[model samples]
Target: MNRVEIDGDRCKACGLCIDACNKHLLTLSSDLNAKGYHPIEIHDVEECSACALCGVICPEGSLAVYKEIKPKKGG
Candidate 1:
């Protein structure tokens, strides 16, 4: 499984990540952050491909993508 962690306090709500996401899983939050900007939120984490495009596109560096690693069965 893959996941995206967003730092709302650092996010500027520029919408660049939203445009960069191919899965359309990212969206702006209804609540405002300390910076008075609607932070980005993931609609469906399971749909994320962990392509890192959103994180790469974000100027604020608020988004972090992590890919889960599973051990081999007979290792």
Candidate 2:
């Protein structure tokens, strides 16, 4: 399954990833991290397309997008 892994402790809560998400799946969490910042969270991971826009926009490099690769048949 395609997913985005977030390093909340490293996040600076800049909101760039939130704005960059085309599906608006990313949002600032209500809870604060060790750095006392509201890190970003995925509202619905199932909706994520692994487009990597959020990861690309994040200045802190906190987001990592992973897309599953299935082997082709009849190889």
Candidate 3:
């Protein structure tokens, strides 16, 4: 499983993540953050494929991706 984390303070509400995400898993928040910008958020984590497109397109580099490694058999 993979998770997408966005830093509200670092986000500039550019909506780049939303556009980069082909799965439509990410969306811009309607409410403004402390920086007065609508930060990006994942609407559905389950639908995310960890494509890393959002992270790549983010100009501020506020996005971080954490991928969970699956346990190997007979470890």
CA lDDT scores, all candidates in order? 0.93, 0.91, 0.86
The best candidate by lDDT is 1
Best by TM-score: 1
Q: How far out, in Å, is residue 17 in model 2?
A: 0.4
Which pairs of residues collide in model 1? none
For residues 21-47, what per-residue lDDT tens digits would candidate 2 score against the true structure?
Answer: 899999999999999999999988888
Per-residue C-alpha lDDT of model 3 across residues 1-75, encoded as one tens digit per residue: 789888888998888788899998887888798889988888778777777899999999998887777899899
Q: Residue 51's C-alpha lDDT in candidate 3?
A: 79
Q: Which ranges in model 1 have alpha carbons more than 4 Å from their true place?
A: 73-75
Residue 42 CA error for candidate 2 (Å)?
A: 0.5
* 27-74 per-residue lDDT for model 1 (tens digits): 999999998999999988998889999999999999899988878899
Query: Which pairs clash (backbone N, Cα, C closer than 3 Å) in model 2?
Result: none
RMSD of each: 1.1, 1.4, 1.4
